[model samples]
Target: MINGSTNEFIDRISTCQDTVFIYKGKKYWFQGYMPNENTVHMEIFQIDPAKEGYVWEYNGSSITEGQEEFQIAPIFDGKTFWEVEQEMEWVDC
Candidate 1:
């Protein structure tokens, strides 16, 4: 889990800027994160504007329903999406 607030997570990942990652020939992009209640809202683009994967509001404990849908989101382990992005090569958008 992230060791700090959601904003902190966002700041930490900002160094990556906007980026895309290819996993198993699949493309994923980083959108943004928002902190709500005791959870963090994470959003990522799966297929441009129509498709978004794994858009969720997650607290340190669990994931609850998000405001958006079409979450084909990758498996999130409580870390920021950028943390996951660091593990993959960048793909040009």
Candidate 2:
């Protein structure tokens, strides 16, 4: 919790994965962490728009990597997806 508001790290959903967004044809993997004070349950994978691998995590757990659907929301970051999905009916990316 950066500011206790949770919104502090909200928009980082897209860049929060081991993905390859090309420009000079070089891919970079950014790291994101969502600590729940104790344990961390997350899965990093790729969905769409990004042929590379993206990560989606939460304070809990998911069924599998291939089961994470719903893009406009999940943000595919990890903790943010978990937090937003259950609260706002957002989709998992």
Candidate 3:
């Protein structure tokens, strides 16, 4: 788990250009935070056979060079960063 306050996690995510995390065996790319709603917007990733790498899709639009369909898991669990930190593992990609 992250050993700091939620602010720390917010700071980390805010500064990092590309933040990817693994939660419950799935890869999630951190999009941004919704402070007022207390939710995090994350894009779900899947392996793209054509690109030979991972890719994320938004609203049926591909962000990478692949045609795979993926979903955006906007974390609406109403959990704080500190609570979420316990379940997420940061990926160094």
Candidate 4:
């Protein structure tokens, strides 16, 4: 069951789709949604000191990292971290 705030958040992200946004000069993209819990996940890429990818689950209040340990990890199996990192592209608005 989704909460009102979560529903609104989902509506807003749907309009942007795959667009990436900059935060503190780093790139991030919305990866997927957890409908049961009304949580949204995002991918944060590391570009300096070698490239890497990190997953953060945003639950309206605070954001946390560690996608592999997330309940939705299995959904993204076979998707190597590097693969996601390489696929990242910057988008305005």
Candidate 5:
């Protein structure tokens, strides 16, 4: 249910698969997804600030720190996010 702004996010979700996202130069790893009205809440893997990117699912977004509580969070993890999107029938091939 993501809009155009999320297309690149979606694309990487399919193609890259393993590329991590770095937000505020921090890691926002792959945690899970949630139910949003139009866009499903992309739950980023919570970062511990004490760990690095390769350890957990922690791929952060260039997205700002406070952005997490904003109106939108990107499809955080590419691979699984796309899988969930496909399962939810949000995007078409």
Candidate 6:
């Protein structure tokens, strides 16, 4: 997952086309934007050990969509990376 703020995630994806994020130990790559839906598309992939070089096997895609604030929603999990981070901070208290 993104280690920074929601804005940071937006900035990274906006500026870099190759930006990827790790969630639940799996890597996801940005596919493109869905202007009609006002959401970004991301595809999940798994590293193929059988490959000689860096190869990714298509796993699936992110089911969540971007919020009005540009924060990508978590799939049925009810928690975004930012929310998880916030909870972590509370646990430390």
lDDT of 6 by residue, 1-93 (tens): 234465655555443245555444444454344434444444323322221432221122222322222243443146644565333211101
Per-residue lDDT of model 5, residues 1-93, tens digit only: 332234655554433233334443444444322233333322334353645333322233322322332223334343333344333322222
Candidate 1 collision pairs: 53-72, 53-73, 54-73
Compute each candidate's TM-score over C-alphas.
0.36, 0.21, 0.39, 0.30, 0.27, 0.37
Pick the winner on TM-score between candidates 5 and 6.
6
Give the winner by TM-score. 3
Better of 3 and 5 by lDDT: 3
Off by over 4 Å in 1: 1-16, 33-40, 48-87
Q: Which runs in model 3 stand beyond 4 Å of their true positions?
A: 2-8, 31-80
Give the root-mean-square deviation of each candidate in angstroms. 9.4, 13.5, 10.8, 12.8, 13.1, 9.3
Which wins on TM-score, candidate 2 or candidate 6? 6
Error of 5 at 14 (Å): 9.3
Let me know the TM-score candidate 5 reaches against the reference structure: 0.27
lDDT string, candidate 4, 1-93, tens digits: 112243333344443244343333455555544445545454434433334555444443122332333323422334533333333333433
Q: What lDDT does each candidate get?
A: 0.42, 0.35, 0.42, 0.39, 0.36, 0.38
Ranking by lDDT: 1, 3, 4, 6, 5, 2
lDDT of 5 at 89: 24
Which scores greater on lDDT, model 4 or model 5? 4
Ten residues in a row with the worst lDDT in model 4? Answer: 1-10
Candidate 3 matches the true fold with a TM-score of 0.39
Expressed as tens digits, the lDDT of each residue in 1-93 for candidate 1 is 222343433443343244455543455565444455555444455543445445332223223333222133345445434446445445543
lDDT of 3 at 39: 38
Error of 3 at 89 (Å): 0.4
Arranged by TM-score with the best first, the candidates are 3, 6, 1, 4, 5, 2
- Residue lDDT tens for model 2, 16-93: 443222122222233344454444334444433355554443443332222233233345344334454334321222
